[model samples]
Target: MKNIYDLIIEDSEKFKDYFLNDEDHPLRYFPKFNSINIIVGANNCGKSRFMRQLMSLNSYDGINDLLLIRELIDEYNLYVEMFNIDKIQTFIDKYSRNIAGGTILDQKAVKIQKNRLIKLKEGDFKNIISVINGNKKKLDEMLGYSGMQDDFLKDYSKIEDTYSKEFKPKKYYIPTLRTAHSLFQIIKHGSEKKLDVPGTNDYEKIEKDIFLHTYLQNYRIDKSVQIFTGLHLYRDILNSRNSEKSIRIQFENFEKFLSVNFFDSKQIDIVAKFDKNDNEKGINESELILIHVEGEKETRKLYDLGDGVQALIVLMYKIFMSEPESFIFIDEPELNLHPGMQRLFLEQITSNKDLINKKLKYIISTHSNHFLDLTIEKEDVSIYLFSQRKNELNDKQFIVKNVNRGDNSLLKDLGVNNSSVFMANCSIWVEGISDRNYLKAFLKSYCDSIGKSYPKEDIDFAFFEYAGSNIDHYIFEDEVEKEDVEIVLKDIKALAISNRIFLLADCDASKQSSKKGIRLKELEDAKTDNFIPKIVWNIREVENLLTNEMWKEILIELCNKTLVKSHEAEILLKIDKALSEVNYSDFAKKYVGEFLEEIRKKMGKISSRFILNRSAYEVKSEESFGTIINKRELSELVFNKNFSWEILSRNNEIEQLTIEIYNFITQKQ
Candidate 1:
């Protein structure tokens, strides 16, 4: 599977020659394995481009791909039509303005006068009659017309306020209509043409092409492939007859045909069927029967099966079996499938580990985190974030970064406080389940005590859990543009209601750095690897004070606790009792002092824990307080006085993030 990376396309510049602005350029550095990835983003953010590029690598084709190509072609044609109409309209408007009122002269009658008296010549007679019968009766009478003149002015006077007089066709109407009709005639004929190749007759030629180019060029056609495509159309059924009741396979004319029963074969014959009344009816009402072929005798109407079942069969028979080693792109595989079915399909794909490695891989783009959660452990899997950045000129640039590779640091950059339902706006990303659960419980208890009506179910957060501790490993894209991040934030920022958006992270320490206050050296050491250090050196300096006097008693009781006591105690259950519990009575007596000291000493330090009276939603970082990330970090820091704040200083976006988190927390349904 690692050999998949043998073709690295890191230099994107080379692709610039192939398309307009290097369209559909691909990255050379992709994960190595026979695995599937789900690309997610807002529409038109290059997901399709990437998938198409991948498919081009192996020339995969199936119903989905064909459908996508058709849709794209349709869209392109629409664009061309729109452009053509806009150009024509603009030209007509410009020309009409220049020639306004010019067409009215053609319908007007010219006067025929030579020596003060009018002589009615052949053309002048028509004009003279028009003057007397049309709207010029007064002028005709003044010219001495003998017969009684008609009331020519009764209805017509160019219809005041109406612009119809200025209207005129630039050319003959039928000629233009004929040209347009001719243009569409090609479309009507081309629609019947085989998708990729031109001038090919029926499905047999397509099947033969698929076989010759794909599987059969190297080998002979087998019974399975023959039967699978043979029954695609109904016409092929009647021309050939089978000796037995077994599933009969026949290739008649240009159609692929297969049938089960003798009566079914007759049904497949494309002729119109007569009802009891014997009137000719359209064939649209006929039933389409598909043989499952999985067992001895099972035939079902095509419409009877669920969409997911149909999709599964089509994909398995048409794509999986036919297009080997090609990129299989799926958009939301969860669509129309039950959870059990989803799991079943996932397991089925995962179980074919060898086939997956040898001749198959997939790039499935989706918005469902549930689908992502199912495949967290695949080594070939990675996550990418679409992010955006705004320039000084107010222009936006979009970026796609590999979150797994630590390229852009999305979770850190965005400062999303991911929670669920209540903290619905929070970008709560967790490295493990323990942290996720603990943070949830801690938030629930803290909000409850604040008298803020914090319903456990009302906590608004979007918790994204990763299986591993390394945050960078989750990134899927290599480089993300700033515009991309902003586009993503546009959606995320909408969820915020007023809670401080905090990225609450934890720092684990070994015995050497077991002190309460985080040392500057420890902070540096934690940042050395591919991980972001959570320890705040400045905050820990103040936290260390408790270790000698107040913390000794608190630490001792916490370490030796034999029974669960308080909410904090229960929440920290996973923390070995030896490392994290305290006697409730003692904690209450000393808690006030610790909180007081935090307020006084850690007030303005960039790396110290301070007490935040407001929750995550209410906190905002002003110039005097800090940045967005800083304000957010302050709120999370306030929750635990013993935690250091050095890590918070490194993130400049904390203040804005804090306000975002707070707003998210307080937001209602």
Candidate 2:
């Protein structure tokens, strides 16, 4: 449920001896944190050095090394707090008191008894340490939890060896972009080992087939081929048919992935060439080709594409191929990509589970602020601002501060000089643009119905959107010198920023029945248990407030606006066909897909007057419906004055959300 890092330390060598020899050194431990940990620091502030230190920290075999990064000490502490070794310590204080008063036994004897108790406590800790692995169930049962002991017996490995290897997640650093730009390396692919003699024309060494475009070699000799031999597709798919079949799925999903990443207009085509013998798997070669499709007459090679484009492809390939439970340390990945692409890239890498099945922990060090876009409602990610300041003795010390969207001090750290803190009386945080738009419409409609003026934005109310897929930032931990003043960190974290705050979340297509995600569950508990003004949507998103009739009306209007006048009856039929496929219980993306497909099938060649006559959203065949239709515009145009949003005719989740906002704003006023 949470990503926990018990401790994070920097410059392992400089502090290793201090922690080992000086037991009095102060300890710093973190609360349960998110998974994606980023390190952004000033130039030469040990950003890359922190990565190197953590990776090599495990090479040493000392107790302090384990003490620093390992969660073993924390586990032992939690275990002992719940259960004690012996009850004898209860009276040890009495013994000490009597010895000091010269009333119990002789002074030396009593002192010896206390010493024995101290040694006994230390031994008890050591005994507990011997059984502490990463396995929680085993530790619980071993400490005499009754029923768990029977279940503990089932896991054979737990009983066999309590002291396993030191826990370290796998690590994989991305190769430099300079190495990836070439985009190809030739390796031998055959049944037997084919060594490259110095002068011979073997493809392993003398690889010029890609530039020469020559594949007229004899049967299965490594003379030439495989320009993209280094890529995953070339290695996995050995022949033409298999390559096409595998890439067909990629081709199917590539466009959608691009859509999510905001690359809607860009078109890429796969141009592949197999070994001359398509079925000859014995010693065959495959060359993966890519074409940049700008138009029918204009095409470009992979190298001809922009660096950001190539980096996107390369980054996905590397991430997808990464082993599970690995750390991918990427330094300055935003160098080639623009600001928009930077945000989209992080969003894609974090959530795209289909393309990336493995569990990867990305630790990117960057100078770009786009990745830190409005992370107030974000869950399971931490953005630590690294800075170095001189200590009391004028010695340099590293400082890592967990930054959140609510902290006004973060603006100062990011080099904004003039902005002051914002303390709103009441606030509402939603997930997306359309959610905000829909809520505003309902608020207006509801407030009008009740004869109360609607709350003004940023004055009477502060409406914040978590910018879909961008709602996951960390809890703030302060590092600035208070200058003899006390600052409460909890008050600065996003959740506690405003005195009365509302968090509006979608069910995420769990359909509001079950709760999922760390922040969503936290917000739910806040609303139910803490009486915070947060609500989870019953439907998937605010756009889904439109029921079947609402959808039919909207789709019919869209058809009438777009299609030819003579085809009105036929367009109505298509709208019905689209509505027949909709599952009312699901989200907009699911139900809207059917409408898009049916509309596209009949309206492909027929350009509508709304699209052609004026500058509305363009409808492209191979593009996404999102790019084709503006959902935000549609919500504002259709539902703003519709008054149906606040009616609750189909259960007004949005109307109820509007009520929470209204109450907050009214009380504040």
Candidate number with greatest lDDT: 2
- The digit string of per-residue lDDT tens for model 1 on 536-641 reads 2222211222322233233323221223233334323333332233332232223233433333232222223222221222222321221122222332333333
Question: Top model by TM-score, which number?
Answer: 2
TM-score to native of every candidate shown: 0.28, 0.42
Candidate 2 residue 553 Cα shift, in angstroms, is: 25
Which stretches in model 1 have alpha-carbon errors above 4 Å?
1-7, 10-28, 31-34, 57-287, 291-299, 387-398, 405-669
Prediction 2 global C-alpha lDDT: 0.47
Q: Residue 158 CA error for candidate 1 (Å)?
A: 77
394-463: candidate 2 lDDT, tens digit per residue: 7645665566645555554555443333445567777766667677667766765764545544445566
Candidate 1: worst 10 consecutive residues by lDDT?
Answer: 172-181
lDDT of each: 0.34, 0.47
